[model samples]
Target: MPVANRIPILCLGLLLATTSCERPAPPTTAEASDSYNLAAYIEQQQERLQAEKPMVLKSVTTEEKPTETIQTAEIDWEDELSVFAETDLNRPALQEYYTREERVLPDGNIVLEYNRVEDAEPLVHYLRLEMTPDRVLRQLNALIQDQNILFYSRRNIQLTADPSSGNISGYRVQGVQKLVLSDSLHYQIDANL
Candidate 1:
């Protein structure tokens, strides 16, 4: 039990303990092969995705064909005149006023031959009545009031007058007026009166 001898034994025990402990072995090539397989699988997926990519799209072209033109023959003047004459004669006012046979010419003209006293009177009255600009405008306004017509234009009155004379000689008016019956349907009146 000498102190120097005990010290030598303790040093020998520490040397043996440190030298006996062994380090763990490195992974085998099989583990490395597994990691390599995973990388290969990812590369394969990427290659598949690239292969399935869509191609560049292109626009389609269509063939053009020449269009055909159609020509119609002109109608006869006598026929046109007759149609207009018939239309005028059939009007409610004219029918009520005239008790005569109306004839139509080829040039879209009407010739009225009165057969009764009433018819003659109306014809004379129409011929004698003056259709001045002011009179015409007054008549138009009366008609609008009588018919209960409403104008759709933003302005109350859509008319133009002569600057120098201060008279409505010639003008054009266009607007929508409400009808009596249904709310949906409206009358579109456009005229130069």
Candidate 2:
């Protein structure tokens, strides 16, 4: 075929190839899965707090000889709650890595626990969500750890929310970090939203 004639054919073939395949559907906000929709939940909270822009009383304590600092100001909820977001286990890749357990307390609270499968070393080692009987989330807790030859850090993160209003009331992050050649550092952050 002549180049002039082949151009149209090539264009047609390219168009057909491009249109033949369909894009995978994006996961929905209420994506149905065995695990809780943690990412979506965090996103919802972030959106709510970002719009509200409420003032927060935050306290930070650090070092072996603890030095405490306190401040009250409006904060970026998305950034402040990002550590909790990092612990989200709703990704498709993680669906099979963690096993979830559920139990209802005699006090009428529901608890959901997620733990890694044996031999799995996901960054968020443990996650627990406690909710009211009506499904209002009361609290969330997680343990996040990262370690390598050069550095190691472990943190316990907790978020407490109001049962009736579902508003985050407070959160805490406590942890220690150690570098290969430096002394360990201990730190804690408590924020009242």
**Best of the candidates, lDDT:** 2
RMSD to the hidden true structure, all candidates: 45.9, 5.4
Each model's lDDT: 0.30, 0.84
Instruction: Give one digit per residue, the lDDT tens place, for model 1 in 1-193.
Output: 9998999899999989887775434335442222212123224423543454322122212124332222222323233122112222222333345444334446433333333235233322221111222222111111111132542211111223333333332222222344455442222222221
Per-residue lDDT, model 1, residue 171, is: 21
Once superposed on the true structure, which residue ranges of model 1 sit more than 4 Å away at CA?
Answer: 1-156, 177-183, 188-193
Worst 10 residues of 2 by lDDT: 26-35
**Model 2 per-residue lDDT at 128:** 99
Q: Candidate 1 has what TM-score? A: 0.16
Q: What value does the lDDT take at residue 98 in candidate 2?
A: 82
Model 1 residue 181 lDDT score:
53
Candidate 2 residue lDDT tens string, 44-143: 9899988877778788888756556566556777888899999887666665678878899999998989898998888999999999887788999999
Q: What is the alpha-carbon lDDT of model 1 when measured against the actual structure? A: 0.30
